[model samples]
Target: MYISAFPTFSFSKLIKRKKAQVFSDYFGYENTRFFYRGAYAIFYGVKALGLKPKDTVLVPAYHCGIEINAILKAGINVKFYDVTHELEVDIESIKSNIDEHTKAVFVIHYYGFPQEMVSLNKLCQTHGLKVIEDCAHGLFSFYKSKSLGAWGDISVFSFQKSLPTADGGAIVFNDRKEDCFITQKKPALLTTLRAYLLLYSEHIHMFKGFLFSVFNTLILKPSRFILKILKRGGSKVITANTNEFDAQYVSLGPSGITEKLIDSIDAHGIVVNRRRNYQHLLEGTKHIKNIKLLFNNLPVGVCPLFFPIRVNQRDLMQQYLSDHGIETFIFGKKLHNLLPKEQCPVAWAYSDELLCLPIHQDMNPGNIEYILKVLEDENCPLN
Candidate 1:
């Protein structure tokens, strides 16, 4: 069976869940609000910020297009900024782009590594611009002593990426003074069922391989139709890791089951295991000639979302990994056409060369070692 990028469903967690009364206590954050997906959180958060129509928000060029969609849907104008080839935000580029009309700076913590928040916060403070931390890859991630979600004016999280939940996204207000609320009805039953089935097939070992694929392909279309009839999360079947945004469902909230599923996650175990796997690969791949590690050192307090690498040939390397029963992701290759044609060369290069490796909590040392060997193989010409 092929390994997945994020941890899959574990029935063990569902077997032991907290009651509704303690749901608030589980996350331990008083100002956190849940949504159907990260894009919804972005949409609502931008709205709540009280920006006027066509007010510009600065965004990274190497971004998931769905985020750009959410901002556009919120009636906000977007200005792209360059991020270094190493995936670090270009502070100078950002400073140069800020204008009187720019109301906010959207900072994405690419692959759970927190951006230089102190510097960013200081820069934003001088210009009176609100900072929105896109922590979609950064649940339980910390920058120095402070947490990623707590550093920005508004922060967004995706439990669907970090946990076993079928669907969940959250917006957290860093400043307790800012009060915002969102209420959404539970998704349709068919939508929830389809999500669970997909999770089971992907995450559960017993259900892996061709049979699961056959089942999903056969039932997905019909399930989507039933979902549309039932008015679920959306009319379409929105799978995880989708490249495009589904604007129709931007207003929807999370399923009722997500609340319970999220509580059962072991945050510490996830961090420890993922870090171990990442460090393992980082150390082993240092000598390879054809690729470059995005972040060479795992910093203290940082929880990585994936092992991002820049390969000489992304498509060929991805196929090489897939043939060995390993899966890889081309994170954010689909740039929005709306971005200016001439700007952001570094981000454009990254979109083509960058490949995301699976280093989820589910992977063991053997699994990580196998992945390393594949990349470091002398016989394989990944370049």
Candidate 2:
């Protein structure tokens, strides 16, 4: 009865979903570049902006750190802007931070929620700053009847974040001048193998079965040593953290396997199921006292990645669920160290209080019921 925080690569869905158009083909092969990881995509996109040295890109104060690392690695300065406690981009904070050296504003669609794209575009246009849409959490997210990644000057997406890919990322230049282009190479074999193995190990721990138990006892327990020795994200089936950005990986493109999976995924089914599961949690959690949902409404044209909530005892609640064979993880709990917490206390405090419950494509109504029962039994806020 174990449930995973991350979506599993389901063979069942693979059978139903036929191979379709590839990323490069859909986005146009000429301007799209793939990468081994999302951070590398960020780096490549930042470099493609044709920004000069000493140019500053304004980013949110609350972030997972990798985006800033990628931007800095591209030989650019970064200035942190405030994000309101509600997780919306603060436009005034952005305005206050913009200056002559500010060349771009990197907007993240946090946890599949859309930002104020129209207003942000207007401001960026007036200030002459490029908009880089970081859609790492926003593959299926949409606003105003339009998809998220296409709203900016250029965009980046991470398939591993939304889909059950071994690893993948892509950078799309809305319009790239000839001088701004760079050729990308395929990823190394070791890099491809490591991510797929992690995906396999994640699948092994996802559900309860006699065969999975035997495999865990015989193979995984002994191989657990080797698995740990292999540098990776949370091998416990919830991979929320990512490795820091590397300069060498900037030239590495997505693997063939990742590209294939992207074309094979059930795009419509994934979006529908996830939205349904999210509504179940939303309606079901109302009676659960002392717990607060991050966003009260599931806006139209938006697909949520996770059900985020703020509770007083977030760690304790996370552990309680883990003990029950249900895994949940926090997002952005560890902010980029360079961001001064004192400058934006609301964002920092918001980070510490936040946790994301699973609402991935694979989950069902029964799983939602089980999760709701667990929250009620333990009285989640336990403050």
Candidate 3:
């Protein structure tokens, strides 16, 4: 059988019921202002405030390009900030970069791990800057008493990223109400249906690597031509590299079926399982030299997206894991080289060393052992 970085949902009956209840209960938003995608929230938020071109928005250098594209799309300038060795935002860098032109700061709770929001919030408050928390990896995860998305002037969550939803997103405001955009809601039905069908298709069995390779080569790759044709009408299509900001503009709140799937996810249980898997990986790798674990907290309030380990032979280690049926990832490969040399020295230095291992809810002890055995083998050479 193939092992993947994440698991496919069986779409059980109970999960469907819970999805709606949890969304209604947890996300208490009325029909104030809704959009099809999360990017529209950003667009509307900035547009409603009458923000103009040349205004700067601070963002972490270690973030997806979609966010930058969104800011750029709004005709706003983007300034990059550094992330700490712990993979949290470098607040000092943010402080140094803020100026009269800096209107907002976009912070991401990377890999479902909470950033030091308490401190970041205080800094933003003192600087009189608006905060936009990117909760793409942080849905259902909390920082302290409040959820990550709740801490900002405006927050965005990617249903496509964390939830079982095939495609959609939510943009929420804490204090200010945004003007409504004429969102095309019906068009999303086809995309969502396609995603759901793919989720349950027989092709899902090869999720380990072969499936991704096949999907990328066979379907996903060729779809660009079709998307180009659709784009002529000013419509955008979702792709693996779809920008975060653009996603926001088009993504809407979860659909009925997606809500049901998310509800069945056992959010609490998923966190518990992930924490257990994290502990197992930590315990198993404690004796391994030249490898550093990013998290300082053993059981962080943040639900981990994956267990990141920094090792010397990162590429070789990734290959080894994949060759043995254990999937690995370079979480922020695109982000490292984008920033200035001096801004994120630590992140850049360690970027090549970082490798994310599979630690999703479906992973178990046997899978963990198989991963560890490969790492512990003395014959495994560095590079």
Q: lDDT (CA) for every model shown?
A: 0.79, 0.79, 0.66
- Expressed as tens digits, the lDDT of each residue in 130-154 for candidate 2 is 9999988888778898788778899
Any residue pairs clashing in model 1, and if so which? none
* Candidate 3: segments with Cα more than 4 A from true spot: 17-22, 31-45, 48-50, 187-190, 201-256, 336-338, 379-383
- Worst lDDT run of 10 residues, candidate 2, spans 233-242
lDDT pick, better of 1 and 3: 1
C-alpha lDDT of residue 157 in model 1: 84
Weakest 10 consecutive residues, lDDT, candidate 3? 13-22
Candidate 3 colliding pairs, count: 17
CA shift of 86, model 2, Å: 2.0
Q: Output the number of the TM-score-best candidate.
A: 2
RMSD of each: 3.6, 3.7, 4.7
Evaluate candidate 2 by giving its C-alpha RMSD to the native, one decimal: 3.7
Pairs with steric clashes in candidate 2: none
Q: Between candidates 1 and 2, which one is better according to TM-score? A: 2
Better of 2 and 3 by TM-score: 2
